[model samples]
Target: MWWQAAGILLGAVLGAEVLGRAAGWGALGAGSREGHRVAVTFDDGPSERTPALLAVLARHAVKATFFVTAPASERYPALLRALGVAGHQVEAHGRWHRHALLLSPWREWAQVRWHPRAGGAGPHLYRPPYGGHSPLTRLFARLNRRQIALWDVEGRDWTAEQATTLAARTLERTEPGSVILLHDGPGVTPALLDALLTGLRDRGLEAVTLNDLPTRRITFWAGLWRLASSYGA
Candidate 1:
């Protein structure tokens, strides 16, 4: 039984690694830094809240990565430009936050690959809507050469009826390499960024931009998304 359990664990790890390489679903590994380093990632955004969040980040002198939807970015293209100027990393979060669990890898690749908002090529990273995961999804990401990043901490900002309480608790529980999840959708305003940014500062954590780290050069899948850098477009 113990051997079986070990085998499963090993398989999952190896499988994820192989799938990540094969599908381009991995990220820069050296990102884990000294001190309590952590990453803040927002999803489904470039919304009205995005501007507010940008201001807060600027004031606090911090940066956070945004995994934005194509349409939302298209709707607020200027905000996308601001995010870039602020030195934040822009990543792909699918065309919209729709479900595609049963989607084939190729279709998933094309959906994100061709998004005009994404500036043509898919990003090196992708976080599925609602944390959705599957082998096909992984495969597609690998084929596109993107990473399927899962989070370590989530503020549940979408359920922000009482965001303050949740945000505070999240800070108290975070550790190094923690990926904090936020939202920039309709109800998820940039107003919520204050608490999160404050929490990070109080704890003496440095927020990082993807550009701060060297790009993971998995040449086996490098050129898959040539335009992943069309972040501001």
Candidate 2:
């Protein structure tokens, strides 16, 4: 009897993973690789460090997308306004930073439903925290009319001890159509962004917002690879 119950539980877990992967196919992780365009996106911010990050982006004349948490948006309405004023695309990163997989069904629904009051009109996008998705994550996105935005490249700036090294490594990984993932809350991000922008310029890659990036739905295997590589599957 115990073995039968264990088999059922295992089957359920595998079933969820399969469905989640299928649902994630519609998500945009990278744009077409034919052009020299990339999108630079920042997550979890509007923090005190965001002003400096904004300055760096401004200096480079690059417009990036910021996937901001609802709590941060509420705490720093001015920063949210500033993001819009600066021509950056602001989207929802969720109600909180917790991964969707860790939340209950109701909480996950609320997470996708919660958008900043300062967010603009239609065509909203949502990026789950840690790029983690539950079985129903895509269903919630559909109900809320939000497109799930995932990244193809990660800067991993949060783990870096120095901005220069992080920027160099990130630049090495970035290519055409890369949706680069960086964070706005980290102290090193400002400098890292500066160096990254400069490197992108040197490599002849233009950094643009997701709207400008000529995106396409991620291929099934590509999306699976991205999830596995970035979030350890």
Candidate 3:
């Protein structure tokens, strides 16, 4: 019985890992539809390219969300301020781009430090790097009372892919209530953002911030356990 229990536990862990990698690890979404409700979220930024990204969004009159790292927030406090001032939602995206699976329990929590907000201080949304989560992530969420966010649509814009390709991929994957994952860091281009915004409008989707996305709160423990069990079974 003991051996059987151990095997089940191991299977659960492996299953959870696979599901996380494949499905953005239980990230929140507004669900699939043909409605005009999509959240545009950018990660790994406050870089030199961020201002341009902001400008593109502003030009389109789109309010998006930014998931910035602590070091980037520290280095570019003004950019973070600008993001907030522009009426964009700013949230946490860990301290670096390393995988959460490799972090220690303390380091995991520490990595998700908050950037000061214009409304106040601290973060309300947490998007793990690479959208990967672990048991420590759930524990951090439970302790800190933060919401874990995952994306339903992604463009892989951080790679060497062209702006047109990025735009096309995002448009291809997006559904109503999709949480579109993009990057405002080095590799992202103004053309990519512009094209994406235009593409979204063409598809009858409105770009919104996380706050604007329809969300229902779930108890952290229950949600975490449920996600694990579903994948395990």
Worst 10 residues of 2 by lDDT: 15-24
1-233: candidate 1 lDDT, tens digit per residue: 99999998678755543444323345442245455667777888888777777877888887888888888878889888888788788887887576554456566666545332344444567767765544456557666666665554677776746657777777875666556778876454455567777877788776665445333433433323322421222
Total clashes, candidate 1? 9
Query: What lDDT would candidate 1 get against the real structure?
Result: 0.64
Measured against the true structure, the TM-scores of the candidates, in listed sequence, are: 0.70, 0.89, 0.81
Clashes of each: 9, 0, 1
lDDT of 2 by residue, 34-66 (tens): 999999999998899889988999999999999
Using TM-score as the measure, name the better of candidate 1 and candidate 2.
Answer: 2
RMSD of candidate 1 to the truth, in angstroms, is 9.6
Name the regions of candidate 1 deviating beyond 4 angstroms. 1-34, 102-106, 112-123, 186-189, 210-233
Q: With candidate 1 superimposed using the best TM-score fit, by how many Å does residue 223's alpha carbon deviate from the native?
A: 28
